[model samples]
Target: MSERTAQLSVRDGRWTLYVALMGVPVSQWPEHHFGAGVVPTPSERSRALTGLGFVFTDGATWAWEEYPEQPDDDTSPVRLLASIRVRSRDGSWS
Candidate 1:
């Protein structure tokens, strides 16, 4: 599958990455919590997941996450993604 990345600006207000799978937010999905990357990295995807888990991507309307078993969220690898619109901090697409 092709993966896309988007950077969001929280200058207006803090944002959250909302992944809509099957027309429903992944967070709202059963046992699904977004992952954040904490150890600062060059990768936008890594940066987001490093610390800010589940935060929305820039201008992202929908996102994608791999919940271990596709639907088996309880014991899944719920990674973060930018689906709808992947933008960057400088108002550009990543």
Candidate 2:
């Protein structure tokens, strides 16, 4: 058998984008140890949704949620949240 290493993937990139877009304020969560500032384009946002394993509900909405691997019980607080709400110049959220 060959050994395999766990390398970083697109999911990790998406998660990083998600945290930045949500304005989670890294200062408050130093444990994550993320530096401030991120500016992604509309295309980048769309790519992240798919990369992060989000389900596309419509043209503009994407969502992702799931329990951690190896849960201790049936009721572990679900790791869930909706992400990305794009708005056009006309002032409408897509």
Candidate 3:
């Protein structure tokens, strides 16, 4: 088991959370949230990610509280882009 850094970005007005191992994308969540304020519950998102061996490397509190402000249009600003760390189920780092 190995771990690596992951990124969360906004693309095409959607949230995309992804991790790559050995330069290959291993896990990705393209629709982490339907909208800024419409984000899933922390437990719900965590449960979905845990299956991929990803636990929010940031504090749990932050994960729950930190969210990107929704873009009102294509030219709107993106305020919630972030990079996070992820480890394998066995607690190893890549």
Candidate 4:
């Protein structure tokens, strides 16, 4: 029930990490199917997050803060995104 806005940049390409968890939807997969019950295993989870290079916002409100290489430094802009996580009805979270 909360919402905010933020942005993030990569490769120092004229962008700063100002984005926050803007639109992250709730857990798509149920806690039981989320990689092995509530959360994924250390190794199994690590491998999944190892190649994370995209931003995903699921239309949900999230906590966000901006440090900006400086305050309101309008010298760069970051690309923000929106992600969607559909909850399965088969009592499975995958």
lDDT winner among the candidates?
3
lDDT of 1 by residue, 20-66 (tens): 33455545522223334341223544445334333334454533443
lDDT of each: 0.36, 0.35, 0.52, 0.30
- Give a tens-digit lDDT track for model 2, residues 1-94: 1111111112333324432222346443211212333434446555544444332333644444465434887665444333544322232211
> Which candidate number would show the highest TM-score if scored against the true structure?
3
Q: Model 2: runs farther than 4 Å from truth?
A: 1-16, 19-38, 61-94
| RMSD for each of the candidates | 13.5, 15.0, 6.1, 13.0
**Candidate 3's residue-wise lDDT over 1-94, tens digit each?**
4546555555566655555566544543322443544444546555645665667654533331234355446555546545555666656434
In model 1, the runs with Cα more than 4 Å from the true position are: 1-12, 23-44, 47-94
How far off is model 3, as Cα RMSD? 6.1
Model 3 misplaced regions, further than 4 Å: 25-41, 57-79, 90-94
Higher-scoring candidate on lDDT, 2 or 3: 3
Q: Provide the clashing-pair count of each candidate structure.
A: 14, 0, 0, 9
TM for every model, in the order presented, reads: 0.22, 0.26, 0.46, 0.20
Greater lDDT among 1 and 2 belongs to: 1
Q: What lDDT does model 1 reach?
A: 0.36
The TM-score-based order of candidates, best leading, equals 3, 2, 1, 4
lDDT (Cα, 0-100) at 43 in candidate 1:
50
Angstrom error of the Cα, residue 45, model 2: value is 0.6
